[model samples]
Target: MDLQTLTYIIVGLTFVLYIGIAIWSKAGSTKEFYVAGGGVHPVVNGMATAADWMSAASFISLAGIVSFVGYDGSVYLMGWTGGYVLLALCMAPYLRKFGKFTVPDFIGDRYYSQAARTVAVVCAIFICFTYIAGQMRGVGVVFSRFLEVDVETGVFIGMFVVFFYAVLGGMKGITYTQVAQYCVMIFAFMVPAVFISIMMTGHIFPQLGFGSQLIDAAGNSSGVYLLDKLDGLSTELGFNQYTSGVKSTIDVFAITAALMVGTAGLPHVIVRFFTVPKVKDARSSAGWALVFIAIMYTTIPALAAFSRVNMIETINGPEQTGVAYDTAPEWIKNWQKTGLITWDDKNDDGKMFYANDARNEMKIDRDIMVLATPEIADLPAWVIALVAAGGMAAALSTSAGLLLVISTSVSHDLLKKNLMPNISDKKELMFARLAAAIGIIIAGWFGINPPGFVAAVVALAFGLAACSLFPAIIMGIFSKTMNKEGAIAGMVSGLTFTVAYIAYFKFINPEMNNADHWLFGISPEGIGIIGMLVNFGVAILVCKVTTKIPNDVVLMVEAIRFPKGAGDAQDH
Candidate 1:
C-alpha cells in the first residue's frame, strides 16, 4: 500500500479499537467515570499511565530535540523517568491510601477546607489545560504529515475522536484505550529504531547499535564508535559535539529537577493511582509505568545518534564537499516540499553545505527529525506510516487523560463541591461531559497555534505543575500540620509566580528572555525549581502562623502514611 493508504488503515483501525473499548468499558457511575470503579489491575493501569504520560512530546519530539542538542537532552530522559521514582516513593501509595477520586478531593479533604479544594481545582484545570494544548498540537502535526491536511484540520479531527471516547466512556474508556495506545505507540516507535539500527550497525537492537561502530557505505567496519563519528561530524559542521553537552551543569540540574517534580505532581499522572484497587497496587503500578517509559526513554538516545549520523552522511559525504541538490535522496526532496528541510545555494556552487554557520545551504527543523528518520534511512513506507499512527496515539491518549482531569475538576471540584453541594451524581456526570467538550475545543485552538516548540511548550506545563501542585501535595500527605490557609496561599502564589515568569518570557518580551535576564541563570524551563522552593517556604511560614490543624485532619494524614487497613478506607 501507498503511505497515505497505509496510514489511513492503521490510524482508522486504532480509532475503531478505542471506540470499541469505550463501548465495552462504558462507565455506569461517578466512581467508574472518575476512577474506573477503582478496579483496574496494576499492570493495565501501568500501561495506560505510560501511554498517558509519554504524549506527543515523548513520541515525536524528544528524540528530535536530542538529535540536535545531544547530551543536554538527556535531562528530559532522566527528568521524566526519575520523577516516577518520586511518585512511587513519596506520593502514589499515600495518595492511593487516601482513596480519593481526584487530586482536589485529596487536597480539599486533607486541608479541611472547600477553599483549598477550589484552589486545587483551578490549578489542576490550568495545569491540565496547558499540557493538553501541547498534546493537541502534537496530534495536529501527525495528522498534517500522514493525512495530507493542515494542522488545524488535524487537531479538529483528533478533538472529535477524543471527545467521542472521553465524554462517552470517561476514565474507564480512557484507561482501556490508553492500554491499546501503549501497545500501538511502543510497537510503532521500536520498529523504525530496529530497522535503522540494523541498517547502520548490523545490530538488531538500536541501543547496542548506538554504542557500536559505524559501518561505511562499502560495508567496511570502522574502529570509531557511532557516537564518536557523530561527535566528529557535529564538530566538523560547527556545532557542539554530539556525545557531549553545552548547557551549564547548573541549568541542566535545575531543568531535570523541575521535570521530575512536575511529573510527580501532574494531576493526570497522579490521578492514575486512584484507578488501582489497592495501595500496594498503586506502588507496583508506578514501577510498571517506569518500566514501560524506560523502553522509550532508553531508545531515544540511540535514535538521536543514529538519525544524526544518517543525516550528516546523507548531506555531507566523507570527502567534505556536500551533495549536489539534484543528487540528494528522495526523502530529502520529499521533505523539502514540506519546507521543514530547505536548501539555498548561497555561493551559486549548486552544492549543499549542511553546517551550523549562517552560510550553510541546508536547514532542518529539529521537530521533524524523528518523523523523517524512517524516510531518511530509506526504510519501508509502512514504517513511516506506522510512525504517523504512533504519533497520533501518543497525542490522543495524553489529551484524553488531561481532558478527563480538566472536566472532573470543573464538575466534581468546582461545581459539585464548591458551587452546588447538593448536585446529583447523574447531573454532575452530564456537566463533566459538557466541560470536556469545551475543554477540547479550547485545547484544539492552542494546538493549531501552539505557543512554542512541542517540547518547550510541554516543559512549561511541567514547570506549572512542579511549582503549583507538587509542593502542596507533598505537604498535605507528609505534614500533619498543613492547614487550609497555608495550602491555599502557597498554591496561588506558586501558580501565579510560575505563570507570570513563563508569560513574560514567552509572550510579553521575547527580546529579554535569555539566561542573562533569568534569575540565577535559570531558563524558563528550569524556573519551576525556584517556584517550588518559594511555594514550600511560603506554605511552611503560613502554617506556622495559622491555627493548629484539627485533630481529625491530623489523624487523616497519619492514616494515609501506612498501608494497613487501606482496603477499608472510604474514598471521600
Candidate 2:
C-alpha cells in the first residue's frame, strides 16, 4: 500500500479506538470526571501516566535534539526521568493521601485559605495551557506531514478528536483511552527504532547498539567504534565531538536540575496520581510510569546516533568532500521542498557540504531528524505510517490530560468552590465540558499562529511550577508552621520573579536572551532552580513574620505526611 493510504488506515484505526474507549467508559459524575472514579488500578494508571507524560516532545523532539547536541542532549533524558523518582518518593503518595480532585484543591484546603486556592488555580491553568499549546502544535505538524493537509486543517482535525473524548469521557474516559494510546505509541516507537538499530550495529537492542562499532550504509564496518567515528567526523567539521559536549559542567547541572524540579512540579503529571485507588498505588504507579517511559527514553540516544551517522554518510561520503547536490537522495529532495532541509550550492560547483565553515551548502533543522530517519534508512512504507500514528498518539494523549487539568481547574476549583458554591454537581460537570471545548479552541488558535513567546512557554510552565507550586505543596505537607500567608507570598513572589526574568530575556529583549546577560551565568532554562530557592527563602521568611497557622491546619499537615491507612482516593 502507498504511504498515505497506510497512514490513514493506521491513524484512523487508532482514533476509532480512542473514541470507542471514550464511549465505553464515559464518566458518570463529578468524581469520575475528576479522577476516573478514583478506583483505577495502579498498573493501568501507570500506563496512562506514561502516555500522558511522554508527549510529542519526548517522542518526536528528544531524538532530534540528541542528533544535534549529542552528549549535551543527555540533560533532557536525565532531567525528565529523574523527576519521576522525586514524584514517586516525595510527593505522589502524600498528595494521593490528601485525597483531593486537583492540585489547587490540595493547596487551598491544606493552606486553609480560598486566596491560596485561587492563586493555585490560576497557576495550574496557566501551566497546563502553556504546555497544551505545544501538544497542539505537535498534532498539527504530524497531520500536515502525513495526512498531506495544511497545518491549520491538521490542528482542527486534532482538536476535534481530542475534544470528542476529553469532553465526553472526562478523566474516566481519558484514563482508559490513554491506556490504549500507550500501547499504540510505544509499539510504533519501538518498531522503527529496533529496525534502525539492527541495520546500524547488528544489535537487537538500540541502547547497546549505540555503543557498538560503526557500520557503513552498505552494511560493512571499518572496525572503528561508533562513538569514535562520530567524534572524528564532528571534529573534522568543526563541531564538538559527539561524546564530548562543550556545555560548561555547571550549565548542564543547572538545566538538568530545572527540568527535574519542573517535571516534579508540573500539575498535569502530579494530577495523574490522583487517579489511582490509594497512596501505595500512587507510588507504584510512578514506578510503572518510569518503566514505560524508559522504553522510549533509552532508545532515543541510539536513534539519534544512527540517524546522524546515516545522514553524514549520505551527504559527505567517506572521502569527506561533499555529495553532488543534483545527486542528493530522494528524502533530501522531499524535505528540501518543506524547507526543513536546504542546500544552496554556494560555489556553483553543485556540491553540498555540511561542515560548519562559511562555504557550507546545506542546512537541516534538528527537529526533522527523527521524522526523516525512516526514509533515510529506506525503511518500509508501514514503518513510516506507524511513525505518523505514534506521533499523533503522543500529541493527543498529552493534549487530553492537559485539557482536563485546565477544564477541571475552571469548573471545579474556580466556579464551584470559589465563585458559585451553590452550583449542582451536574452543572459543574457540564461546565467542565464547556471549559474543555473552549480550551481546545484557544489551543488550536495558538497551534496555527503560535506567538513568539509561546515557544518558550513550556520552560516557563516548568519554572512556574517549580517556583510556585512545588514549594507550596511540599511545605504544606512537611511543615506545620507553613501558614497560608507564607504559602501565598512564596508562590506569588516566585512566580513573579520567574515570569519577569523569562519575559525580560525571552520576549521583551530577545537579543539579551543569552548567557552573557543571564543572572549568575544561568540560562533561562536553568533559572527555575534559582526561582525555586527564592520560593523556599521567601516562604520561610514570610512564615517567620506571620501568625502561626491554625491548629487544625497543622493537624491536617501531619495527617497527609502519614500514609498509613490512606484508603481509596475519593474526590471530595
Top of the candidates by lDDT? 2
Output the number of the TM-score-best candidate. 2
- List the candidates' TM-scores in order: 0.97, 0.97
Q: Could you give candidate 1's per-residue lDDT for residues 66-91 as a string of tens digits?
A: 99989899999899888888888899
lDDT to native, each model: 0.87, 0.88
Q: For residues 1-572, could you state the per-residue lDDT of candidate 2 as single tens digits?
A: 89889999999999999999999999989989989988899999999999999998888888998898899999988888987788778999999988888999999899889999999999998988888898898888888778888889999999999999999999999999999999988988888889988887888899999889867668887598878878888888888889987777877888899888888888888889988877888888988988888899999999999888888878887688888877877789877766678888778888778887785788998877877888888899899888889889999999999999999999999998899999998999999999999999999998988876655788898888889998998898789888889999999999999999988888889899777788888877888888889989999999999899899888888888898655554445
lDDT, model 1, position 102:
89
